[model samples]
Target: MQKYLSLLVLACLLAFNASAQQLRLITGTVKDSLRNAGIPNVVVRVKGTDFLTATDAKGNFKLKVPAGAVTVEAIATHFKQKEIMVGASQTTVHITLNLLQPLITDSEKNRYIMDDKKGLSEVVVTGYAAPRIASGIHIKASPQNNTEDYSPINENIFHTATDQPLSTFSIDVDRASYSNVRRFLNNGQMPPADAVRVEEMINYFDYQYKAPTGKDPVAIYTDMAVCPWNTGHQLVRIALKSKQVDTKDLPPSNLVFLIDVSGSMDEENKLPLVKRAFKVLIEQLRPQDKVAIVVYAGAAGVVLPSTGGSEKSKILAAVDELQAGGSTAGGEGIQLAYRIAAEHITKNSNNRVILATDGDFNVGPSSDGELERIITKERQKGIYLSVLGFGMGNYKDNKLEILADKGNGNYAYIDNFEEARRTFVTEFGGTLFTVAKDVKLQVEFNPQFVQSYRLVGYENRLLQNEDFNNDKKDAGDMGVGHTVTALYEIIPTGKNSPVVNWVDPLKYQQAKIMGNQAEVLTVKLRYKEPQEDKSQLLQKVLPYSRQQIEQVPEDFRMTVAVAAFGQLLRNSAFKGTATYEQVLAWAGKARGEDPEGYRAEFIQLVKKAKLLDKE
Candidate 1:
């Protein structure tokens, strides 16, 4: 027994030594060989294993790998992936990638180079449920962007009307997702499922809802119909119409354009496009408006002193002269821009910092928590932020969304010149001015009418029911001309439906509920004046639907079509039998005059999606 014990100890020691010998520390920097700039957010993974890490702001990465003849692959969006071998003796390595296409390529078309090491890895699919194809996108049951940041979608579940009936969420007016999805489609690729936000897509286009006619700043429009996607389910549309402020009534502006000229922003879709976009905005500014140019790349500094907006040539030249280079130092840039805005801000003035970036906040206050706290603190001083996201691939939507949410602002994704015009030119007042802040909504569904219900597309914007009255909590801000639309799919009582996730009947509550015969829901809205702490309240009671699906209004039909399109892009489990053909048919009929051609453009997008999805 003693001899066997000694042999066992020796065997264990040998095994431990072998394992240690196979492990190695790997370090490297990922860079673009042509430009010789470090690439941040590139995924560094050991093939056939779970070990992974991403390159930092400087494109430097570190990883531990099993050292004997192991393969290391670097993955990045739009950049050609590369693979290299690290032997037992190797201590450090370097990876140089060829950018498939620069952000500012000569051609407007996307030409992503395909290679074995370039496509999304197998790991992406296993995070969620089994893969489901959405359009051309291969969606994993769970989607993790590997190196990039994206907030996960926690699909809301149906709540039994008897168990818990209140549904509340912050109103989201940010229309970033629509243009972001359009970016993918125009590039001939499917957008990541998380990028297709249903509410934003529906809110992007203008609808002919009647504006507020009374003293109220906002009006409510409600409609209901049998859901086209799931016949047994009912779709409820709740929309808000805010009074539009004419340009002449708008207050004088103090604008600071905080531009990112980081190396990653050097592409045609980035810095160059930004200059052009800002030029368009410059053309719209009035003589009373003041504009300042501040840029960041490795460091932050003011490029142009505060100039009167009437000097269009000076502002245009300042923007055109700006060039892209160096590393991203977003936190530093933000501080300087806010400082500039503070100096120029006047009482009742439109003081705002227009942050243009790809959401790469590499240096200082970069993380979500840190940035959120800092930006939130800054907004208390009456300095607002409006984030204009540009470019793709390394785009950090999650981070920019945080900045906008915390900074008392809105966000928009500018994919091209047309979108830039739409956001900066056509919607100038909506883009810059704010009428209401901390807007929140709560709906109390009547137990006598509703069996179960689910709110669509505000997954990330959902708020606690009690938060409706909480004046301290921050919520979405409403722009001067911004309109918000929300939808809920309900299961009526006394109906047999699979979606009605029936729980065991309560043993204690035998009492029946008494409610108004016409009231289906009571929606309450709370909002604060842009400068005030206290909130004002608005309420409206919705009656049971009087219109059938075939007779629904055009706005309702168009909204339904857009919402369905978004769900299809997300591969929503709730979108039962919702086909692209149906989406097309419903949207085509709802196409109004579309003077701006936005609705017409949406119809064309649906056709493109149908072709791409082979539906």
Candidate 2:
């Protein structure tokens, strides 16, 4: 048998009902020996056996070990592996794991150096992550930061604009990636490539796109320009702006705060930050609005029943008194939150469950598929969900991504008090009120003006071309005042760029003749009112006109710059010589308004990322 010399186990016995005689449920909490905080995602299993289970957010586990099993092993990502023995009659045990410092190979040692200027230093993994550097590095990450999961981004390939004239996708208003990436950067680490969503980064700051003037609630804008990286190619920009709604005019809200206070959240950044964030949001609630608080740990329960937002002090007290120290039961919390929302749901109101967590749902129904299925069924009842991410270690980006994407909601990451302010105070209306749902976008390129083209970013937001007109299909949700942007890199016709994929010309027939027109592509948008079944269609035709790169709106160029930065981050196949230097240059020139200073902050981030770029 394999040996683990570090196992430290504690055992205890409790009474059980006679009906439980058929199965012995082994339940316990796992924790780190250093800080005594619960360790998440620890593998818990019967030693030398296939029977196994993993520890949840609070480092808790419940396993149905066979009657004869006595020895169990616990293994965590950055902790020393351990094995512990259970007492003959014990049904519960507590296991603690000692931290394991990674063996520093000569190659790895060369990649990382202590930055005296910063309190904590970045450990650069040459190939897997970005070059990390500088300051507070407060994501408070252990070696476990690198273990978080994110969906791989598959860069779209170029298609002959003639052969595939349609570029269809869902309009994404989710800015989770931008804040998430900022968390890593502020922590002196380059965020994982997949965590950098270009479109979200671009849409993070407000743009000057004109709001809708017609009966439709959304407006579309498009512009084409010479690609900065390769002058031979062109870049197309598309923007969608939703009409702004006055806070007082917005429908009364029915909000449920679904919080995860598992033992993993006991950290300063997790539960503590979450409570403060909810308090900030409480300040924005109107008299007509109602709020409820539901928290989950080893079990789920309501700390505060549905009450008028005017009772702010009572709500704040409930939030302040929350303590974290149990396994996470995310599924139960979600269900209970939905049930609470459903009970007091007001027709036509902004009904939503605001979930704040680190995305470590390790207990029942923890998998993305299971959580998504649960949220999907609940959303049909008219209750939307907004996932607010917190903290870093064991953060499951993919799980939150799926939850927000499938839950008819938006997602945001709360890194610090400032982000919490931005999400709750500055963007209150958009964060809580949805103006349009099932929003979809489709674009058609005139083969005459453009050759092969590739849609930039939106890798996770792409929809099947056929799903565009299908009203039954669930796509994305857009909130009041939200803006969605998409970009396309095109190889203009007759340039014969070698970058595009090749397909043989048809052997049987002649192609359509080109007309002498400046038209490039047309933009089409479909959206339904929050509670409507039918989608309203809106269209705008974009002509192919060469403009002095200087003439394009400053906001348009800024978005372009952000997209380029993302491409550089991902080392995308189509980035074509784009550099962080170029991104900084474009962003600097386009830095216009300073109202919120978001654009200015973005420029600083670019500077930080450039230093972290090994390439």
Candidate 3:
């Protein structure tokens, strides 16, 4: 028995020594640099081996490694992979990961870096320049210096102590914006092989109108009858007319043009396109308008100081000299541009900084919070901002939209030359001129007529219930001639609708029946005068079951189809009774006399997109 015991002890010791020699244990914690929080679900794998393990909820990871030196890799979605080496017997390791890329669709892949060698083949070309005829309305849409009567008193008031009054405003969606989308989808092609920016698609139509020329403080107008293809629904047109002002407008102007000249901007659709767009504005500027240009690449710099707008040649030359290279320093550029604008701020005229980019701000101030802070601080200087997104691929739509909202600016995506011309030339007045600020829309459903509804699009624009009345809260900016659209899908009361999913009844409670059926949707608009700190309210009501009105007009139906297409592109959850074929059929009926051939182009785009979808 004693001999057997000795032999067993020797065998156990040998087995323990062999295990220690064959394997080594490794442990570590993975954390995010900015958030300083553990990143769970990170995969840790032994390089060149099948062994793998994931981090715990607390970001702690452990792995047994083979005896010799080995490489351990860590990977997570939306973050760059990280690797570390472990010598034999190495015990603990610590790691920090900084996310390198943003989450976007494949359509936005090559947006940030310019591929000059590829030339202009990637760009979408449009027809001859059709000069816009000013309809005898005395308005200045470009940045300029003048003491014009049109300037509002609150122009320089960033924050005011007085109780300012708010007013109500309404927006009619543009039917033309969706024309191409409808046509393209109807023909079963991808909505133009080119990029289809959803914002431009919605902003292209002109709705009905009641001139603000007199009676009401605010009135809207549209000419839906002009389109031959409209069918099924009534089109509500709202035209925002500019306030009349002479050359000696209200105040001198301070303008900062923040441009992105990163490596991604080397393409003709980016840098060259931007230069051309600005040329249109430079020609329209007056001497009183002070212009400055700030550019960012590997670093940020003020390329041009505040100069007279009349020096069009100099500004154009400066624009032409720009070459794209290096990384993006968007955060730094914002800081510098704001400082320059504030330094030369005019006491009366419009003071604003316009940022033009592909929405790719990769290097500094990359996080949402960091960029938000920079924009929020600049807002305090009474300088408004406008974001003009250009190019595609790596386009940070989510970030651009957020920055624009926080900075009290409007956001528009330019997918082609025509779009650039529209924003910077044809509708220049509405694109740059501010007619209303802090515009908030709240619809109080008549619970008696409607059960529940969901707002389509504008997910990022959602506001809290109390934010509607809070005068201090900043909202969307409405430019002269600009129109905004919001839509809701409602489930009427007492209807056996598939749209609604009933919830379980409360304990000892009976289902409540809606008592009245008079009201339908009540739209409340609250806004501040262009320059004011106070807000005013406007109310409009649509009664329940107006057979005449609910019988959607041709133009309205066409717009609905366009909206449906947008919802489809975004993969929205609220899309109901909307299909590509149905949308195409509806659009085909509304293609009225499209002289510019835009409708035909849309049909082709839709067909291509559909094929891609199938593939």
After superposition, which runs of candidate 3 have C-alpha atoms over 4 Å from their true positions? 1-200, 211-253, 498-517, 546-551, 589-601
Off by over 4 Å in 2: 1-146, 506-516
On residues 413-482, what C-alpha lDDT tens digit does candidate 2 reach at each position? Answer: 8888999998999888888888889989899888777777878878788888899999999989888898
Candidate 3 lDDT at 327 equals 94
Residue 477 miss distance in model 1 (angstroms)? 1.4
Tens-digit per-residue lDDT, 1-615, candidate 1: 999999999998997677667667778898866447676656677764434566765778877676577888886543455799887688798999874433222233222212223222211311212122111112221113333445555455567777677898999988999998887777655566667788889899888878787876788887788888877678888999877889999999999999999898999999888998998899999999999999999999999888998898988888888988888889888988988888998878988999999987777657777777767777998888999999875788878888998898888998989989988888888888888888999999887778778898898888888898999988988887778999998878752332232244467765666668678898999988887899999998889874666698888899999999998776564666788889888889988787898888887787777666531
For candidate 3, what is the TM-score? 0.63
TM-scores of all candidate predictions against the true structure = 0.77, 0.77, 0.63
Question: Deviation in angstroms for 284 in model 1?
Answer: 1.2
Candidate 3 lDDT tens digits, 1-615: 999999999998997678656766678887755346666656666754434455665678776667778888776532456788877667888878754322222234321221222111122111112121111111111111211111000000100001111212223222222433443344443332112334345456543332357532444322222111112222232234324333355355678889999998888778887887777777767788889999999999988898998887898888888889999999889889999988887556678888988767778887889888888887766788888766544455546666777877766666566666666666666666666777777766554544444454443355676888898877776666555655454444442321121122235433353434564655677778766788887666665543332244555555565666665543332233456776676567656665555555655555555565541
Query: For each candidate, what is the lDDT?
Result: 0.78, 0.77, 0.57
Q: What residue pairs clash in candidate 1, if any at all? A: 103-267, 103-268, 103-269, 104-267, 104-268, 128-141, 128-142, 129-141
RMSD from true fold, candidate 1: 16.5
